[model samples]
Target: MQGRTLNFVTKSMVKTKRIPKQARAKARIAAILSATDALLRSSLPSNITTTAIAHTAKIPVGSVYQYFRDKNDILEQLYAEASKQVEELVLAEQSAVDPALGFDHINRTLLQCFWQTARSHPTFGALTRWANREHSFVEVTPGTDSSLARLIMRTFEITGINLPAARKEAVLRISVTVVSAVVDIAFEEDDADKAQTLIDELALLLSGYLA
Candidate 1:
C-alpha cells in the first residue's frame, strides 16, 4: 500500500502553478477530478466525453481542457492528487511521532489519520480504488514507497520491539499491508459503520500483534 509501484499515466503533466490564490485552481482540479470519479464508477472512459465533465462541472468544455490535455491527462492528475493526500496524511503524523510512545500508539494514530481522511475526502478513497483497476492513473513519486515503509518500520525502534531482523522485517511488511488493506476496505464498504468497525477491529488486532 505505501510503496506500491503505481506509475505515470500520460505524457502531459499538469503544472498546478497557474492556480490563483482565490480562484483556487487546486479546488477546480478537485472538482474536475471528482467528475471523473463519477464517470469511473458509472461509465467507461470512452463513454465520458468532455461535455459530460463540463455539464457535471457546470463549466464550459474548454475549461476541462484548460487544466488538462484530455480526459486521460486529468485522470492522471487526479490519481496523483489522491495518492498525494494519503501520503501527506501518513507523513504528517509520522513526522511528529512522540519518542515516549510505543509502536502501538503510533499504529493507532496512523489508522486514525487515514480513517479521518477517508471520512472527510471520500472521493480520494474512491479514486484510489478505481486507480487500482485501471493503471490509466499512476503519477506517484518513486521514493514514496520506501519512505513509507521506513516510517512504519521506525515504530519498532521506538517501541523497543526486540525481534530478530527477519521478524522485524516481517512485522513491517504485515503492518503496511494491513494498514492499506483496511483503508481500501473502508472505502469499499461505503457504509459509515463499516469504517468504525474496521478501525476498532484493527485496533484490537494490531494491539495483539504488537504485543
Candidate 2:
C-alpha cells in the first residue's frame, strides 16, 4: 500500500504524450487544464469529452490529443494539479504559523488553508467524486513521506511533542486519513455555514486525538 501510494504521488498518475518544455507548449497545456477545470464546474467528469475540452480551450482536437490520450487522462492530470495546489497552500500556511501556538491552533489554521483552496477550486468536489468512484485516488499510508504527514511531523516538532517513531507514524497516518474524510464530507455540503461547522468539529476532533 505504501509503495503504491508513493508511486502515485511521485510519478504522474497518468502518462501524457510528452512533458511540455518550451514556453508555448507549457502555456498550451495550462490552457487545456484550465478548460477542463471550467467544464468540471458545471459538468460531471464522465460527461466531459476531449473534443469538448479542445473546443473550450480553442485548440484543435489533434492538439488535445498531442498531450492527452482521452478525457480520463486529462481528468487525472487535473486532479494531480489540484492536489499540488493544496500541498503548496499548506506549506505556505505552515511557514507563517507561530511556533508558540499549540497543536490545535496550528491544526485549525492549516485546515482553514485547505478549505480555502478546495473552495476556490469549484472543480475539486466533482473531480474528487469522480476519482472516488473510479478508485483512482488511493488511500495514503504511513512512511510514504506525504506532504500532510511531513507537515504534521513539523507541527509536532514545533509543539515539542515526543513519541516513539513507530507510534508517531501511526498517529500521523490516522490523523491525515480522518481529516481527509471529514474535509471531503464538508466539501459535499451545499450550505456554506454547514460546511464550516463540519470543519470546526474536525479541528476539535484532531485536538483531542493529537494534542
Candidate 3:
C-alpha cells in the first residue's frame, strides 16, 4: 500500500511556491481545495480555472497561485487526499475483519467500505474519473503494494493460509486489477442501485475465487 500510495503522491505533487506556516495561510489553502472540490461536483474538469476557483473560494487569484501551481496542481492535490482517505478506510476495515468469520465476510466488509467512502465523498467519484481520464491515476503495476492486495494478504495471514510467495503475489496483483476495474465501472453508473449491484457481484466473484 505504501508503494502505490507513494507512486501517486510522487507523480501528483504540487510545485508550490511556499508551504503554509500560519493558521490563516493553512485555512486559505483548505478553502481553495474545498472550492475546487465544489466546482468539480457541478462543472467539467476542463472548464474549471484558477480564477474561477479563486472567485468561488472568495480568495484572490494570487492566493491560489501562492500555494498551488495551477488548476491541475490543485486537482492532483485533491486526488492525493481522496486516495489517502480510501487507503485509510480499507486499512481500517482490514483491521476490523475477523478470520474466524471466513473470507466471504471479510471480502464483503472491505467492498462495503469502498462503497461507503465513495458515497460519503461526492467529490471522490468525480475526482477519480477526472484523474483517470486526464492523468492515468489508477494505473498500478504488479509487485507494488496495492491497498486491495494488501488487505487480501492480511486476511491470508490472519487465516493461516500458507500460499506460496510467488503465487500469492500473482493472485494479489490480478485481484487488485480486476477489483479496480470493476470499481471504476461501478462508480461510473448513474443509478445508485445498479452501481451497488456491480459491487455485490464483484464481492461474490472474489469470494468464490478466494474460497
| lDDT tens digits, residue span 1-211, model 3 | 1223311233424445568999999999999999999998899788999999999999999999889878888987887777777768778878877779877877788788878776777677776666556644344221335455666678778767667877877777767777777777776788999999999999999878777
Q: Which 10-residue span in candidate 1 carries the lowest summed lDDT? A: 2-11
How would you encode candidate 2's per-residue C-alpha lDDT over 32-99 as one tens digit per residue? Answer: 99999999888889999888998999999889888878888888777777777767777888888997
Candidates 1 and 3 compared: the better one by lDDT is: 3
lDDT of 1 by residue, 1-211 (tens): 2224212122234443245455666677668878887776666555678789878877778877767777766665665666567667767877788967777787788767767765676456555565555532123222324544566666566667677866866776676566555655666686788778988788778789888
Q: Which lDDT value does model 2 have at 28?
A: 86
Model 1 scores a TM of 0.62
What's model 2's lDDT at 142?
Answer: 25
Query: What is each predicted model's overall lDDT from 0 to 1?
Result: 0.62, 0.73, 0.73
Candidate 3, run of 10 with poorest lDDT: 1-10
Measured against the true structure, the TM-scores of the candidates, in listed sequence, are 0.62, 0.82, 0.81
Candidate 3, residue 63: the lDDT equals: 94
The C-alpha stretches of model 2 lying farther than 4 A from their native spots are 1-14, 21-28, 136-143
lDDT of 1: 0.62
